[model samples]
Target chain A: MDRSQLLKGLLDIIVLRVLETEDGYGYQILRRLRAAGFDELGDASVYGTLRRLYRAGYLSTYVQPSESGPHRKYYALTEAGRKYLHQMREAWEDVSAKMRALFDIAENGTAEKGRA
Target chain B: MTDTPQKNTDIADYRIAVERHLADLPASIREDLLNGLEEHLAEVSADLKPGVPLSHLLGSPEAYARELRETAEFPRENAGDRFRRSMWRMADPSFAWARGTADKFTGSAGVGEVGEFGRTLRPAWWVLRGFIAAAVVTHIFIFGNDSLREAVLSTGFFGLLFIVAIALAFVWLSLRLGVRAQEWSRRSRRLVAASGIALVAVGMLTFSWVADGFVYYREPVVGYSTAHDVVDEGVSDVYVYDENGELLTGVYLFDQHGNPLYLGDPWSCDDGRVNNPFEQEEQESAVPDPFAATTEPPLDEGRYGYRYPLCPVVEESTGADDPEQPASEPSEEPADADPSDEPTETPSRTPTPDPSAAD
Candidate 1:
């Protein structure tokens, strides 16, 4: 399955989860995501996603000026965002477990037909 | 650098579109976006194959504009919505002109009689002071040389008047324009009011000076006549005078038939020429001397008397018993007259005595 298709739905959650570990700039975050094997993320698309998540109140931002280059706005997750992420995580796990059980039943029924 | 003029125009248009796109983002975001976009365009152009349209190198300007519009609070289209969006502009921080005009009126005329009276009194006093100062100066100047005093008094009086008039005109205009409210402080209002009062005061003095000059320059003449019984129409004589009271000329008064009546100085005639300073030469010249003896018919008695029509005539007198009695006399005249000579009571004569005048 292509990760790009699923990436849009989980982008806010992913951003919050990433920021939870360590605060990073856009370029740094992009590099980390790429290293973790999500290369399909477009540079503009990631920035747009970050802005949208910040506007939605899941993330907060502050700018730290760099001596050599330009300033960067760093985003961090809030308490409300952490609670939302946890709820989404639990729901996703429940759905995955239920689907697995249904697949197991179907597999068992097909094996019984092959034996007969 | 080697691009044709058309290509240069195209590049400028592209730069404008890209700059507009970048402006939608925050300042921290915009700078990098602009540099990155320009670099992307340059890289894409360099890597392009021959004869491709440059349009492919850029996205739609509208789409980029839409992204920027999402962040900032653009003015709303509907009037009410726009008003609502800029509600902060209506707050105290913004409405200074209204508050300033209101706040300035705190210690003004309407506040109380003491404050208002003080303001009114101040202007009046200032005016009085100015006039007194002008008068004292004028007195010293005039009394020092009686010959030059007349000229100095006349000119000084008129000069003070002119200043006062101009000041009054300015104050009137300022009041009409509601100028006092615009002053940011109370002190300025007092200064304006004081000066304005002084001006009106000086103006009054100037008027008196003009009157005095008129008296000094006025020429007097003799030979007066009283209007006796209706002096009939005709040209008559009247005399003119100069500032020194010397006779200037004999003015002629004429009837409608062009006849002259008692001719001499109008000022000297007590058969009395009408005192109209504004009368034209023709009106003065055309005045008929009713007292002049001529062939023309005489004016009726009504035109000649100190008339109170309700006044009791000799016949109306109750044989001079109470000389003050009026209404009881005129009505009773016909009753006492010889009945043969009289026509009893005529309808016109009885009602002709105006009831209002009797009352």
Candidate 2:
């Protein structure tokens, strides 16, 4: 899959899952997404998303000042965010299953045409 | 493969970026996120490489932050709260009052030159002053000096008292009449009607003077005298006759010659039809010529003998020590009375009746 295209709706789940394992700041979260092969992710969208999620109550946030520069803000998934992610995962499974079934029918039909 | 911890320096740089980007966000959110990020950096930094950047491990700041974006949950928009704030901003008290004042100035009657109330009042005041001046001037001129002096003097000698009283009356009348005339000016068909009233008063006064001088005083053959009379050096005896030449009444006049001049009765003058001296002959002839054969003359309009003419008696010669004869007193009796009451000789002196009392 083109990771950039496939990552659209998956970033939220991915970020939530990464934060679930351990609380992280924006850069750490970005590293995890890149390791997962989503190279096209943009910084504005990620930071904006973090703020939006924090405002929505899915993520609790905190800031710690650095000796070298300005402060850093960290986000951690809430229980609600975890529960929501689980539901989203289940929904994704059901939709993928339906899509796979449709594709199977088309491939089987085309294979019979070639034999003919 | 990616088990290494992020460098402290890289993490710190990323935190600064995030903090800068989120500056305008709500105070609580900004503070909380900043604090959390700082703590996360401390934890991530200790085992990290001295030179290896966080960007090398995280792909890039753009990719890292983007991955966080799709999952973030934002608060619901509070439209009602925003709307209330906007309404409060709109409700400026001074501006509202100013708008109301402007509306009233435009909407209310009067206050401006073109306003209904002012329009009415201005024209009316103009007319009222004109009318009052014309009327007062007319009255002053028609009655002339005598009546005015009498009327003013009769009021009293207190100047300030009368002035204040008149001023008060003038103020009250001006207010009332000014208002009324203004109203009429607006509604009347002819706005100049007020001028007509003033003209009529002036015309009437003019008529009075003209008629008195030219018509009343100048009636033909009628006695004329100044308001005062002088007793001349007089003959011992005097008498007055009527228009019919009958002796009416007289006092005595003695000449300077110490002689009584039995001057004929003072009241008789030549008897004939004397034309009205005040009227121009052309004006007189404009009436149907009595001499005209076509005229059916009216009985009362005919010219007749000296209609109650009066004459003065004087000695034939001028001399000293002439005793002045008392002026004749106007009789209260009818003008046509017979002159038989004339006394021919001097009578025993008795207390003369007070002249003013007789009047």
Candidate 3:
């Protein structure tokens, strides 16, 4: 499966999380995502996620003119964005915990069958 | 940060292409989506390697726009909107084909070099478009029915300078607009495109008018000689007389350059009607008499074939006329004659040379 396809659903949460610590512009946010090992992330995916989040009132933007370059529209996580990120994190943990427990039970069942 | 003009143009062009793909979206939403795209693209370009293209780093503009659209969770078009869009697509089948061909060509190898070369020429096209736009605006609003040449001529040197200044202003305005057009709403963009088409139409009409003016100014007026010695005071007929007071016939006159001296309207002798001097066709040879008119001339070489006295008549009244008296009489009679009657009286008065001599 395409990694971008897998990352599609999580882009909003991932982008919100990236903006949590510090407000970042499009290219800078994309860079941070790359550093976090989502190397196959498409450029437009991050931008679209930011747009969606901003539209949903989860992110706020401000224009920060660069000293050496063009002005950048920086995206910061709003109060709503932070709360949403927290909920997403909890939901992700809940699903992963359940999957881990199911995998352990399956492994034990396979082992018992081997013993039989 | 240190982007060259070419780099900036490339980014601007890419951003516009992406925006074009998003034209179906709500204007507010599309504007919001593209608000800071230019700066973002510039940053993206800054991080690229020296020769790396933005499209190479990202994907095709269409794919990028699609990804953006999909990931943004924008509402899909209704069936009716989809149908209308498909109909539009069908209406411009050539546009689609050309776009596909361009995409394929750009995707192939060696396009980078070509693209880079083409990028260098973008500024020149922008400048030319600005000039044409300025010319159209001035021709319509400022110059007011004056052809471009006439406007320039009437305006004189400083006015021309002012016009150039306006064109330069337009160039600056166009360059700025071209860069920022990606941020405009679709409606505004369409309005601009429509105005652009209108401007081009006006420019072409003005250009043709200007071209015709140039042709008119350059064309020499027929029957009016530019030569230094040729008399331009409407000398309709040349009456040459010998020193012995007899009318000269079958005479041919030439200047020092060996070119036959063409004086007056050669067609004036027939039907008492002169041809329109501006008519492009060369005049027929001078007819000796309207009753005896023929296509073939009595003399073979010259255009005005008739000898000096086009209407020759045998002298009836004066058996022997003084040459000095006839010569002096004509000069005074022509000066006193009505200018309108000169051409008609010239042919008829050939035989009556002694009227003043008899007086």
Candidate 4:
């Protein structure tokens, strides 16, 4: 299966993890994610994801009021976001275990026996 | 941004393009997307050569919008969006611009001029708009007793209709003011500013100066505490105010010179909303103009006397402080005060059902 579909949903968690370290701005967050080795990540994707989280009360925001052609919008995690991250981590662990078992069984000749 | 017209137009063009695609999105999302896009564009532009366009760096505006749409995790599941969608259902049919209205502006020469003029008049339009918005906000949050609010808040089947109607009018005006001012000339901009100032002045005048400046000072009129006394004494009076600031009880209805009021009939629509007026009936004519011919002539005939061949015209010089006007205090006329000398004095002072209107 193409991992892109799987990665799409997990990107939100990855973004939250990045924010968990320190509050970052749009372009900064995108840079941090790229540095963390999600080399294929798109700029619009990261920014859009941040907006989605911020709007849903998963993140709190304030303007930097920077003197610029454009003002920087800063995003930080909320208490709800912290609670949410814990639940997502547990759910991820469960999914991770189930996938490992499936991979191991398929590698063992169980897949060939089932086909016969 | 302190950019040159060249740079500003570049960004403006980009913003407009992005907004065009975003017309169907929620306002909050569109705004966030724009802000993020703006900052990103600015940062990217900083690294570019002076003559390079943003499109050269970011690729097509259409592609950017599509990328944002696909990637952004919009909060589409919220109840707020549901409510907004419903409000749109009510507002859109009446106020939504036709698809080609914008294209028509650029396509036609005559329309372009009219559109430009409308944009020039925007500053004035905004003042009146601000007043309306403030009025609605105050009505909802500050005063439940306001009549405009009451009309909207009326219970039962009709109330929904009233609420919908008010909301429609509000949305229509806002949507109608879509003309952007970038293309307007400096002279046109100044005209807009001047008209805005003029409107504000006129608005201030209505607070107290209207009706020929009759409400020059606070009247020693009746208030809620004295409502019983007014009704018991049977004074069917009328009130005219500039701004509906206070239902001021102590208002004098005549000009400083105490000439009979040259004011119009009381506006009862916005009246009696917050405070219960002493009585809840239509105000009787304050001026008794016997030969005024029309059922309602303005109070300005300011008569110490009239020279009619048949009818006597009262031309009494009574400003607010006419000394013998202890006589003006009572609702009834001093039967001896010559009618010709004081035209319509008593009716103006006392709030009484006009005997003439009955006729």
Candidate 5:
């Protein structure tokens, strides 16, 4: 299984979570994602996710003129986006806890079988 | 931070490449996908080391576009789309190279400015397209029999005004459509493009047909009229003579206007005895013998002018007496009488002897 394939489903939630803290432009959001250890994340993937989220009313954009370069279009999370992100967080926690419990049970069972 | 002009162009080129890949999508969707792409590219470029190519860091433009499309949840490619994509893939390299060469040449030759100047004339193209569309429509629906030019020309002042009004309406609609094209669905935009191509094709064909008609009408009619035998009296051979009663050989005849006088069959010997097989078979019950030697007339050296002594074999055999024989053979009694009456008379006498000899 490809890590990117796994990342694809979570991209929406991750992008939303990133914007939840503060407003960020395309490159800024990408840079934050990279710093968070998504080294394999594609630049277009983030941009595309932002566009999808913006179209879905989960994000809103504003053009801020920069002094050095071109004008930056900043993406901010909407109220609905925050609520959606909260639900995703809960779902992620629930799945991870179940996975951890399963892993522990398997490990203990293997240890007992080896001793016998 | 402020970037150099070269960097800006690189970013723009990359963005354009990506946009071209996503061209199949609806304009609104495509625009949304690419909205902040330029600024994003710039920011990425700002962090890059000097002299590093953008592709080295960002991957191929094609891959970027693919990733973008996939992430955006744009509809998956169907078989038709896949086939079209494969075809494009085959042609893309050469097309890209040609485009790059053209861009370089234009940039170096100052033609890029001319291109920019042409971009400003897009509205003119739209207006011309409208006029073409109107002409095509009118030609098809209103004046089916007439060529486009004739239809337009024959139409009086009011008709011209009506056509102009129709063209203006088309222009107005085209302008409105162009303004809102970005909001239209992909299918509708494709339909418009296909119609535009169709209009242009029809306009070119009709205009070219009209142009050919104009050329055809302007041509001199005399050439066509005199292309075959000038005299319709079925004179298959012309024999000319001087005042000394001597038959003239290689004498070229011309009309009063200095145009070459072309008379007779010019190919077959239809002098009274040696008949054209087809005509003889048709007229008389004479079944032409296939093995019988039919004399071939002298080749017309002067292709335009009528040359004298059309049948050289007959001329050589009978000498000056040949003219009288051909003239009187059709009328059996005249043969015997013509020889005795004018043995030394000019060859012109032969023409008057037998009126039916013209056949």
Candidate 6:
């Protein structure tokens, strides 16, 4: 599976999860995501996703004067955004468990068929 | 973060490209996106090695803009934008000139300023204004004295107006685009502004002489002449002047019942030119003059005195005694008739009789 394709669906959730801890500006958020091993993540794409989240009311942003750069916009999860994140995380876990169980059953059934 | 010169230029270039792709976005959305992206770009550039293209960091500006657009709220296309599009597509440059003019009057002259739709009409009106201005200028030059019927039906003049307006639109559009593309410096822009002010000052100075013609066209034709004109046209030696001394031409009169009385337009004459009413009344008396020369065809004079139609204003509304008595007495007063018996105060005309006039 293409990592970029997979990144598309998870980008919003991943961004919300990251911002759930603390508010982070554009470049800082990109660096944190990269450090967390999204090595192939497109830099501009992540910024676009952040903007979408903000517009969607899943995140809120405020400008803070920066010491090193131009004024930076810090994005954080809104209350609505937190609710969305919690709901998506539960759904993801349920899907993940179901898939894992299906894989386990298939493996065991194949071994039994070989022994018979 | 402080951007190096190279970084700033790269960011600018990136933005320009993004803006080009995103030009269709509503102004508010476009501005917000650009401002946010500018700060974001500045931050990213701080950590990048010098000379790395922003395009390298952001894929292509078009793709980046598309992603942002997908995320941003796109309000529906409004009537104003739609109208703007129609004008630009239908008749460019001239309509564009029209647009600028319309914008100047968006909230002016009792027009309700409905957000964008209202704004759209301004440009279209502005475009039509060019045509109107052209028609007016044409009217002054070619049709100033023409009767209304001839002016409206003159296809040649209308064609000329269309051609002139289209030509002007072309020149205006070229100048506008040229100034924009060249990004004229502030000093040059000031020179243009100074020239415009100078032109306006010149217009203000010369406005009075030609202003009457414009007003004459705007007003109803009935305003130009007076009812006295009819009496003057019939009698050659006699002339009509309103109490104010303006030779009453095509003036309207109303009887005590408010019924319209048409005396026709006064015959235009050269001599005995009374321009103002407050001037010496001795020279202004509308009564017939023995020496009144006929500027038109030969007119006959009555033997007894300079004869003129004695038009009297009767206000029967005051319940005065038979109004015919007063109305007849004044018409006979004539230009040189004895004023000794005539009451000087017009308001008292209703109350006073012959004895009051002697007082």
lDDT of 4 by residue, B286-333 (tens): 434333442222232224111111111234222223343333343233
Residue B131 lDDT (model 6) = 44
Backbone clashes per model, in order? 20, 37, 0, 25, 0, 19
Instruction: Sort every candidate by lDDT, greatest first.
Output: 5, 3, 6, 4, 2, 1
Kindly report the root-mean-square deviation of model 1 from the true structure over all alpha carbons.
28.9
Cα lDDT tens digits, model 6, B172-251, are 65355434634688677566556545544554554555787765443322322443443344532232332222231212
Residue B15 alpha-carbon offset, candidate 5, angstroms: 1.3
Q: After aligning candidate 6 to the native by TM-score, how far in Å is the CA of B91 from where it should be?
A: 57
Cα lDDT computed for each candidate against the true fold: 0.48, 0.50, 0.67, 0.55, 0.68, 0.58
For the second chain of model 1, what is the TM-score against the true structure's chain B? 0.19
The candidates' DockQ values read 0.02, 0.14, 0.35, 0.26, 0.34, 0.31
**Cα lDDT of model 3 by residue, A1-116, tens digit:** 87778788788778988899999999999999999999978888888888888887889989988887777789899897898899899998898899999999999999999999
Please give, for residues B1-359, the per-residue lDDT of candidate 2 as tens digits. Answer: 12333454567787777566556656775575566655554544433556666565445544544443333335455888767755865886776777667658756643532345455566455545554554455346533678765666676766336544554564566566655654574546255455546655665765576676675333322322211121122321234433333333222222233222233222222332222222324423654333224222222211211111113222321212124322222232224342324333221111121234222
TM for candidate 2 is 0.29
Model 4: chain A TM-score against the true structure: 0.82
Best by lDDT: 5
Specify the CAPRI tier of model 1: incorrect
What is the lDDT for B280 in model 2?
22
Q: Give the lDDT of residue B70 in candidate 3.
A: 80
lDDT of 2 by residue, A15-72 (tens): 7777888887776686777787767775444555666667666899777765653456
lDDT of 4 at A92: 92
Instruction: Quote the lDDT for B95 in model 6.
Output: 65
**Residue pairs clashing, model 5:** none
